[model samples]
Target: MDLIAPVVLTRPAGRNAPLAAALRAAGLAVVEAPALKIERLAVAPPVLQVGDLCVFVSRQAVDACFDGRCAATPWPDGVRAAAVGAATAQALRLHVPADAILAPAEGAPPDSESLLAVIEAVGLVPGRAHIMRAQQGRDWLARQLQARGWSVYCHALYRRSPAIWDRDTCAILAGPGRCTLLLTSLEAVDAVADSLRRQAMDWPATLKLVTLHERIARRLQCIYADRPADALTVRLSAPDEAALFQAILASARSA
Candidate 1:
């Protein structure tokens, strides 16, 4: 494997280890620059019933929901488990049966729109639903479900706080050599931008971005609008490890 460029991973703490190790094994220099820290909130175990829908928005949600407080409780027999993306679905499999998990088809964008389509295709009757997520996030899924006559309840299991990067990490990001930053959420985009601005640094001309979704890519474009067209390069990838790996390699090759 050829060393392309340093890859900056900005996932919350403890979440970047797997990807970082994989990138390192591929011979790419990996930088652990977590842009957000996940703080699990204390919440009572969700009360689920038969014929109800249970949705997880992220892996963190799955971890938080299945934490020690609720780990011993078995999933209700008839309740359905759904995830926003394949990665979340994978995480969910640890606690639920694979057959019981509902998610977008492999390779489809792992987002609210896609997940909503899948849910509708299953022809599940409008009933009660629980959306497990952070303190704040996009409510498109919940609203969509409500519009379809489903009673939706949002459970906040955690919160995302911006992680402060040290001077050395910022230097690596702002340095001259080509660098590819993998951004998985809009919050991460803001977190990175805020960190760079706080250091009085501008977005590096050599920086390349690989975003998990188009919404996040658009957010980055808005934030870096001042940069010339040629200076900004962004690629979109499905929210899965395989897709992200390929996108990162493509960005490196383009550089």
Candidate 2:
């Protein structure tokens, strides 16, 4: 693995500003080829009951939900909001108070499991809850909440369409350097792999991957198993941008 390879940013355009800036600050070449184009859905917001819980799977969820259907509607007085991680929690704070938001316990992993643990700790055992996210987001959290006897209302706030493979995106994937791809979502990883195939390039052979979870890594392995060159994949301990940069630097130094 070569250190300081060109890093491909696959996050949605609206959400990649901070991470892209940080990557450039670390002296790595960045290719801004978004894998998914987020489109807000035209849906009616559900009324919240007292003691109801609302979960935002990602920052995009918060933005899509509030900026679309719930633009003028205030959050119900006794309803509480929850986010999977600090970034999403920060996004929630833009529309709701810090005290009204619930998140994974500080120092705990920022994931569905941790968020579920926190919800259970706060005595949110049963009642009604809402899960706001992309159209085809993972359903594990919603299923868990339902298992706990909560009436889970899944609101598809946005739709994630595969991004078009423009000339610059094609060049980045087919470039000569040992490029690295930053994949934070499984859907984005699949879109990128499909994009490479559509561009007629041998994908993942000379490319390294920085994925947020082992599930995404497993998916990549399935995609690149037949390829000859083994790609280096680094999985971070956390999903935040700080941990992502640290993992990138550590991988670079070790290489």
Q: Give the residue spans of candidate 2 off by over 4 A.
A: 1-4, 69-74, 226-230, 252-254
lDDT score for residue 37 of model 2: 91
Please, what are the lDDT tens digits per residue for candidate 2 over residues 1-255?
Answer: 465457777888876678778878877777788899998888865777798898999998888777765466777788899999877997888788788899986556667998998888888658888898888988999888888898888998889988967655766754765777778888898787677678776564566777766778778787777776455455554666787777765554444
TM of each candidate vs. truth: 0.93, 0.87
Q: How accurate is candidate 2 locally (lDDT)?
A: 0.78
Clashing pairs in 1: none
Give the Cα error of residue 186 in candidate 1, in Å: 0.1
Model 2 earns a TM-score of 0.87
Q: What is the C-alpha RMSD of each candidate to the true structure, in Å?
A: 2.0, 2.5
Q: How much is the lDDT of residue 13 in candidate 1?
A: 84
Number of clashes recorded per candidate: 0, 0
Clashes of 2: 0
